[model samples]
Each structure stands twice: as structure tokens, then as C-alpha cells.
Target: MHLLFIADPLHSFKIYKDTTFAMMREAYRRGHTLSVCEPQHITWQRGSRVSAQVLGITLTGDPTQWYEAQPLRRAELKDFDAVLMRKDPPFDSEYFYATHLLEQAERDGARVFNKPRALRDHPEKLAIMEFPEFIGPTLVTRDAQDIRRFHAEHQDIILKPLDGMGGMGIFRVGPDGLNLGSITETLNRHGAQSVMVQKFLPEIVDGDKRVLIIGGKPVPFCLARIPQGSEVRGNLAAGGKGVARPLSDRDWEIGNALGPVLQERGLLLAGVDVIGDCVTEINVTSPTCFQEIFDQTGCDVAKLFIDALELAISAGD
Candidate 1:
């Protein structure tokens, strides 16, 4: 199989922990040809198919110099057996527009994983709203009064921006409501933008668990990103320690419930963030933790993903 990965620059990848690197390495090991391009490389002319200037790569065993690559050349998206969209997010305007371009590629017969339309439809933070049963008491609003009322009712709450990734712009307000007004204004951009506020789950101390869903099934093991001292966010990027563990009963419950449903929507992979028993976010854009879980549990998450991708492509044929 020939695989094309639309991801961030190869040089920037932390190969040890990067999930896309794991996928590429696994696929390469299995005799699949690999190519890579960033989202910016994707282009579509009025009369031409969506194409990208991609580099054909061969994975080197050495971590320091991970991959050997061919010079960049233009290729139609439809030519690849699979195109994995692994771009990290702010999910800003450019990312949004890139999805449309990928969607056009899909129409041109490109088999894109986590389908372009599905990515647009499911905003990581907002996606959890669809499954209120799995989440905590949450509120999304731009109105300051609405946030204040929610704070009054929930006492201890977490306020976060709608598009924040890696735990950015997240704040916790206690019963005293310290900085509640300022946080509300800051997060909501003084009524210009909307924010999400949820009842604080003290279980965050246990870790903010990332339940990776691949091919509509749980990965069996999850990476529990536990917060360090004085930090409320348990994101790995936020200095949290990642500990891989077998999924708890509640974690299984959430993953099992959300897995197939999200898969049906063309999300070949997703990361369901769970704090205790509640679902906090449904990350579909580029759900990760593959290497962390594999390193500790020997689960071979990348193999599972590539297996699923192969099965999907073969089924389509």
C-alpha cells in the first residue's frame, strides 16, 4: 500500500512520542510505501484534482535521523492508497479551509481517514456536547450572565476557550468565584466569543485519561496524563506525566459507547478525554497517545491503526 500523511513538518516531530511517526514507522515496516506533506502543500486548481507536493520517504532505524526522503514532487491525492490527516490543531481559519480542500480531494476519489467532512463537523471541545450523558454538567455561552449563573450553580467550575488545545486558556474557579468575572470575559473575549464552562471534577488528580478509539473500538490501554504540582491541566504538553494503564470500567463504558458512533461518522480514529467518569473532549482532528500506550503496554496501537486502514481500503476496493 502507498500511504500519504498530511501532517506537520517531519523535522519537527518528536519521533519517540509522536503518533504519526509511529504510524509511518509501522506502515513502513509492513512494506507500505510512505510519503508526507503538510496541509499547506495541498492544492486544487479549477480543472485539476486536489494534489500535493509530497516527499517520498523511507524510515531509517536511527531515531536521530528518522527518515530518508525523495525530493518533493506533485501527486494527486487520489493516487495514494490512504491519506492520513495528522495535523495538530488550533483548528484556526487555515485549518478549516484545508478541510474543504481535503473534502474536494475526497470527491476526487482520495481515501482520506477521519474524513474531511467529519473533521469539520466535530470540533473537539464542542463534540462532547452531543453526548451529554457521558459528560459533566457543562455550559457553552458568550453571555457573561449565563456563565455567572452557571458558576453560581456549580460553584467549582472550569472555564475554557472553545478552540483551545493542549489545555490552553483553561481556568478553574472555586466556590469563592475568584477571577470568575475576569475569566469569563477573557475566555469569551468580552462577549465576542463563546466559551465552555463545566463543573470541576476533582478526579483530575487521578489523571486526564486519553481513551484512543481506532476503527470503532477501544485500544484496551489508555495513557493517563497525570498533572504535576500546581498544574490543573494533565495534558502531556502541559508537563503532565503519562502513565499507560488498562482502561477502567468507566473508561471502557465511555469508549465502547462513543467508539462505533464516531466511527460511523467517518472518524477512523478519535481520542476521548475522560476525567473520572465524564467525557471532556472528543478529539478527532488528530487524536494521539499511540506511542505512550505502546511503549508501556506493548499494545502496538500503530499496527492496529494501519490494520484498520488497510481493511477499510481493501473493503472499498
Candidate 2:
């Protein structure tokens, strides 16, 4: 199968730590032709048309030093069996534009993972509000008075940007927290973009679990990320330590409820974050944690991901 990954630059990837690299390596081992490009490399040529500069990729035993093929363009992306929208996110205008382009590609018969429409319709953090039973005490609003009232009610809450990913722009406010006025002003100054405020789960000190689900089934392994001292964030990118762990009954219940709907919507892969039984986020845009789980558990999750991708592509064919 010819596979294209729209993601960050190849040179910037830390082969061992990056999930994209792991998947690329598996694709190479399976003898599938792999091409990669960044989101900016995508362009609309004409109506319902798109193009990109495709870089060939190869993987060696020492995962860090992978090989690459000369960059080229196959004007018709449909020539490739599948395309993976693997770019990391701030989920800004540029990301939305790329999704629009991918939507065009889908119309032309190329299978795009996590379907462009689903990604656009589902903002990771906000989507979970639909399932309040699986979530913590949360409120999404831009009005400072409303936010103040929520703080007063919860006493301690976490405030974070609505469009944030990888644990960025997150803050925890206590009963005696300062700068409520200033923080809300900074977050909503430009416009009325609402921020999320939820009751802080103190059990997060033990670590937050990242559970990977593919093809409507939960992967056996999970990574429990322990935050650094005095830090509320447990993202590996934010200096958290990832340790392998098994999912609890609550985790299984959450996955069982969310998985079928996600697969039905064409989201073949997802990474759900759980802290003390409350679902924090459902990551669909290039979810990570594969490498951390593999390193600690010696499980090659990349193989499972590839198998699911292949199954989806073949079904489409």
C-alpha cells in the first residue's frame, strides 16, 4: 500500500520517542511505500483538487537514523491507498485548511484516517461534554462573571484553552487563587473564545493514563504519566514520566462506550486521557503514547495500528 503521512518535518522527529516514527518503521518493514509532508505543504490546485510534496521515508534498526526517499509529487493523491493526518496541533486556521484539503482528497476516493469531517466536527476537549457521565465537573464559558461563579462553587478548578493540545496553556486555580480577572481577560481579550474550567482531580498526582484505542478496541497497554513537582500537567512533552500500566474497569467502561461511536464516525485511532476515573480529553488528532507504552511494556503497538489501517484501506477498496 502507498501511505502518505501529513505531519511535522522528518528531521525534527525523535525516532524513539515519536509514535509517527514507530508507525513509519512498521510500514517500511511491511514493504509499504511511505511518503510524508507537513500541513503547509498541502495546496488546492483547482476545484475539489489538492497536491503536496511527498518525501519518501525508510526505517533502520536504530530507529533514530531512518532513511528517506527523494521528495516527489503524485498529483493524484488517490494513487496512494491511504493518508494519515498525523500533524501535531494548536488546531488553528492552518490545521482547518489542511482538513478541508483532505476532505477534497476523500471525495476523490483516497481513504483518510479519522475522516476529515469527523476531525473538524470534533474538537478534542469540547466533544466529551456530550457525555457528561464520563466527565468531571466542568464549565465552558467566556463571561468572567460566570467563570468567577464557577470558581467560587468548585473552590479549586483547572482553567485551560478550549483549543489547546499536548497539555499547553493549562492552569490550576485554588480557593485562594490570584489573577482570576487577569487570566480571564488574557484568554478572552481577542474574542469570545470560551475556556474550559473543571474541578481539579487531586488523584492526578498518581499519574494520568493515556489509553490508546484502535478499530473500536482498547489496546492492552497504557502509559501512566506522572507530572513533575508542583506541576499539574502530565504530558510526556511537558517532562512527565510515562510508565506502563493496565487499564482499570472504569477505563474499560469508558472505552466501550466511546469506541463504537468513534469507529462509526471513521476515527480509527484515538488516545483517551483519564485521571481518577474522569475523562479529561479524547485525542484524535495524531495521538501519541505508543513509544512510551512499547518501551515500558515491550509491546509493539505500531503493528496493531498498521493492521487496522490496512483493514480500513482494504475495506474501502
Candidate 3:
């Protein structure tokens, strides 16, 4: 299979931690041709046809380092069996534009995992709000007064940008926590972008779980990311420790409810974060953790992803 990955630059990937690189390496090992491109490289020519400068990728033991095939424009992306939208995010306008292009490719018979329309509809933080029963007390708003009221009610709250990923701009405020006015100002100053304020789950002290789901099924390994001292964010990017473990019953229930919906929407792969059994985020765009899970449990999560992708392609055909 010839696969095109629309993602960040190949060289910038941290070999040890990047799931994209791990999957690319596995795809190569399976003798699937892998092509790489950043979001900006994708464009639609004519009315609805899409094309990108697809570079063949070769991954070695060191994930950071990779060799590339001569860069070339794939005049018709439909030629590739699948295109993995693996770009990391702040979920900005450019990312949306890339999805629009990918949606065009889908219309032209190219299978795009995590279907373009679904990706557009499902922003990580906002999507999980659909299942309030499974989540913690959460509020999304930009109004300072509302935020203050929420803070007053909850006392301790977690604030995060609506569109940010990798734990960027996540903050925790305790009862005596200061800077509510300043934090509200900062978040509101950035246009109408809302911030998520949730009751801080102290159970997070035990670390948060990142559960991977492929083809509507939970993978065997879940990584408990323990944040460093005085940090509220448990993201691996935030210097947290990744420890592998099996899913608890609650984890299975979360997956059972979320899996079919995600697969139905064409999200073949996702990373759902749970803090004390409360679903926090449904990570669709470029969900990581495969390497961490593999390193800790010797599970080849990359294979699960590839198997799902193959099934998606075959079913589409």
C-alpha cells in the first residue's frame, strides 16, 4: 500500500517519543510505501482534486533521523491507498484548510482516516463535552464573569485553551490560587477563542491515562503520564513520565461507548485521556503514545493502527 502522511516535518520528530515515526517505520517494514508532507504542502487544483509534495520516508532505529525519497507532487492523491492526517496541532485555520483538502480527496475516492468532516466537527476538548456524564464538571466560555463564577463554584479549576494540544497553556488554580483576572484576560484577549475550565481532579495525582482506540477497539496498553512536581499537566510533552498499564473497567466502558461513535465518524485511531475515570479529551488529530506504550509493554501499537487502516481501505474498496 502506498500511504501519504500529512504531518509535521520528518526531521523534527523526536524518535524516542513520536508515534508518527513509529507508525511510519512499521508501515515501511510491512513494505508499504510511505510518503510525507506538511499541511501547507497540500493543495487543491482544478475544482476538487488534491495534490501534495509526497516524499518517501525511511525510518531507522533512531526515530529522530529518517531518510526521504525525492520530493515529488502527487498530482492525484487518489493514487495512494490511504492518507494519514498526522499533523500535531493548535487546530488553527491552516489545519482546517488541510482537512478541507483531504475531504476533497475522500470525495475523489482516497481513504482518509479520521474522516475530514469528522475531524472538522470534533475538536479534541469540545468533542468530549458531548458525553458530559462520562466527564468531569466542565465549562467552556470566554466571558470573564462566567469564568469567575465557575472558579468561585469549583474553587480549584483546570484552565486550558480550547484548541491547544500537547498540554500547552494548561493551568491549575487552587482555592488560594491567584491570577484569575490575568488568566481570564490572557485567554479572552486572543479573540473569541474559549477556554475549558473544569474542576481539578485530585485523582490526577495518580497520573492521567492515555487510552488508544483503533477501529472501535481499545488497544491493550494504556500509559499513565505522571506530571512533574507542581505541574498540573500530565502530557508527555510537559515532561511527564509514561508508565504502561492495563485498562481498568471504567477505561473499557469509556472505550465501549466512544469507540463505535468514533469509528462511525471515520476516526480509525484516537487517544482518549481519562483522569480518574472521567474522560477529558478525545484526541483525533495525530494522537501520540504508541512509542511510550511500546517501550513500556513491548506492544506494537503501530501494527494495530496499520491493521485498522488496511481494514478501512479494504472496506472502502
Q: Pick the candidate with the highest TM-score.
A: 1
Q: Which candidate, 1 or 2, has the higher TM-score?
A: 1
Report every candidate's CA lDDT: 0.93, 0.85, 0.85
Candidate 2: tens digits of C-alpha lDDT, residues 47-122: 6467777777665576546674675765556768899999998788989988898999888777889799989977
- Regions more than 4 Å wrong, model 3: 60-65
Error of 2 at 282 (Å): 0.8
Q: Which residue pairs does candidate 3 place in steric collision?
A: 15-63, 15-64
Clash count, one per candidate: 0, 1, 2
- The TM-score between candidate 2 and the true structure equals 0.96
> Model 2, stretches more than 4 Å misplaced?
62-64
Per-candidate TM equals 0.99, 0.96, 0.95
Ranking by lDDT: 1, 3, 2
Error of 1 at 70 (Å): 0.4
Worst 10 residues of 3 by lDDT: 59-68
Off by over 4 Å in 1: none
Candidate 3: residue 190 Cα off by (Å): 8.4
